[model samples]
Target: MNSSAIAAGPVFSARDITRVYRMGEVSVHALRGVTMDLYRGEFVVLLGPSGSGKSTLLNILGGLDVPTTGSVHFLDQNLTQSTDRELTQFRRDHVGFVFQFYNLIPSLTARENVALVTEIANNPMDPAEALALVGLEARVDHFPAQMSGGEQQRVAIARAVAKRPDVLLCDEPTGALDAKTGIVVLEVIERINRELGTTTAVITHNAMIAEMADRVISLSDGRVSEIRRNERKRPASEIVW
Candidate 1:
């Protein structure tokens, strides 16, 4: 971990971010003034319960949604107010996302599934190289049905990292796996961040997973509850979750 101070400010900056949904008339506040900075090459873990704004925050950060009131800046670009076209380009060009589900196309081979993404990216690595990064070179042509959960997840990671994105947003990426399998998936993610220097943010309820991050931010009731810098982060295998 050895969290260095957020250098040169933040690569991704959120300020007093708030998101409210209106049904009929009354508002349901999903994000109640959550603010944070994600520095480049930083591994950040966000911990929170359901309905605690974790996913909402991630969505906003990933350009899938916008804040009800607040600001988000990616590098010097104002993501909060970016036009739809601009945001779409930003997402395609600079962000890579992984979710709880593998989301692989059942009919597509692992390499093809990954290629579906990289083909549209500006400067992507070959799908083969991406799969190799996740230790899936041998399974390149395997379909989702032919892969184990961990292996499928590695394919998802391969798809994400092939684009050389500036930021990687993962939402409960290992939520469905057993502890042992989850660690393997987490290890792949950690390795990608280390090797590519991607600014990574992972949202998970598993508290022990925080030990694998450079900084841990806990959310509660739509707000940031605590932020701690890990003095030293152990490898995923050393984590006791």
Candidate 2:
């Protein structure tokens, strides 16, 4: 990739964002003041310990939550100023999110779970095609209860990407899986980013996962502590830990 392309303005820009929770007499500052950019088609790893505000920031970026102060822009649109209905539309049309839990409906088969999204999306891939992207084509007929943790997670991923959103935001996507399974999950994510060119951000507590990111952003006490570029990005299969 050219340096100029990498330096091009970000797809998502956040400035002076803050989030605070008031617990009666106590005030919890989840994000002090976070400013960052997520470049187009780049895979970013958000590396932080628990309570570091990585997930909070991801939620803000994805329009699931808003900051107490400052502004966030996705492309030319200001998310901070968008109405609830507008935000909902924005999320439905532009963003895809995968959480730590599979959240697949127990009664639905893998293909049906993915079809639930594709059916609503404006321009969606076939449910089976989405499953194939995640290496789950053979398991499309299996229900959530019949699949392993990793397989279920892949189904969740398939559901998220079936709509072909511009960005993919994943919060602790591999948190519930074993080492081998987590790597397999990560490989799927990595493949999606590479092949589809979907800008992706992954929140992870394990620093070893940084090797696969185009850039690594580290958070400390709700603030960005460091941002580094990985000159030689490794495939997720080679990441240990």
Candidate 3:
């Protein structure tokens, strides 16, 4: 964690949160007494195995889900108390999400795919500029099917960031790519965090990727097992699978 970001206080404060899914006779606890804070302009990695609740926590933070118990406050707003419509607006205005899949439109070109978000966003970047930020300047006219996996993922990243969101949440962003391509994606994420100062949280099962984060948050069985801050963060370019 950057000391400066810590000084700025938390952008997100989640307290004593619990999420339960009821399915007929069974109840699944996706998050159990989870409490965490995401600071402004910091890069955090959510490290965990499957069923560890990292994705659940990310979803809650992104306003896609609400906790069954406890509170989530984003700056002055109480997310847990927000209505579905309010949450929808919050997501629209503030949050950006990238997942394992590219989630790009098949018929749309790279610039067109990113333009979708920019069109709905307030004070968004030009789609071409956003694509250039992800090193896809020359490929803006290419369709998702025409680009490589890494390039497609970069388009997804560009779309997510074009709105100039305060926070970026990515779940297994590099899961679909090979090591070389994954590193390229990681580099793009790192650049965004450094340049745009977006508070970023990425979910990954790969421990090696944790080295690039300012802080690594480990989850186990629906709880935060540990939180470790790196004294000196490693560059994504130096990381290997």
Comparing 2 and 3 by lDDT, which wins? 3
**True-structure RMSD, every candidate:** 1.4, 1.0, 0.8
Residue 201 displacement in candidate 1 (angstroms): 0.3
Stretches > 4 Å off in candidate 3: none
lDDT of 3 at 12: 96
Q: What digit string (tens of lDDT, one per residue) describes model 3 on residues 42-77?
A: 999999999999999999999999999999999999
Candidate 2: residue 85 Cα off by (Å)? 0.4
Candidates 1 and 2 compared: the better one by TM-score is 2
Ranking by lDDT: 3, 2, 1
For model 1, residues 1-241, the per-residue Cα lDDT tens digits are 2245364678888999999999998999999998899998999999999899999999999999999999999988999889999999999999999999989999999999999998899989999999999999999999999999999999999999999999999999999898999999999999999989998999999899999899999999999999998888978998776
Deviation of model 3 at 29, angstroms: 0.9
Clashing pairs in 1: 1-233
- TM-score-based ranking, best first? 3, 2, 1
User: What pairs collide in candidate 2?
Assistant: none
lDDT per residue (tens digit) for residues 1-241 in model 2: 3466458888899999999988999989999999999888999999999999999999999999999999999999999999999899999999999999989999999999999999899999999999999999899999999999999999999998999999999999999999899999999999999999899999999999988999999999999999999999999999888
Each model's backbone clash number: 1, 0, 0
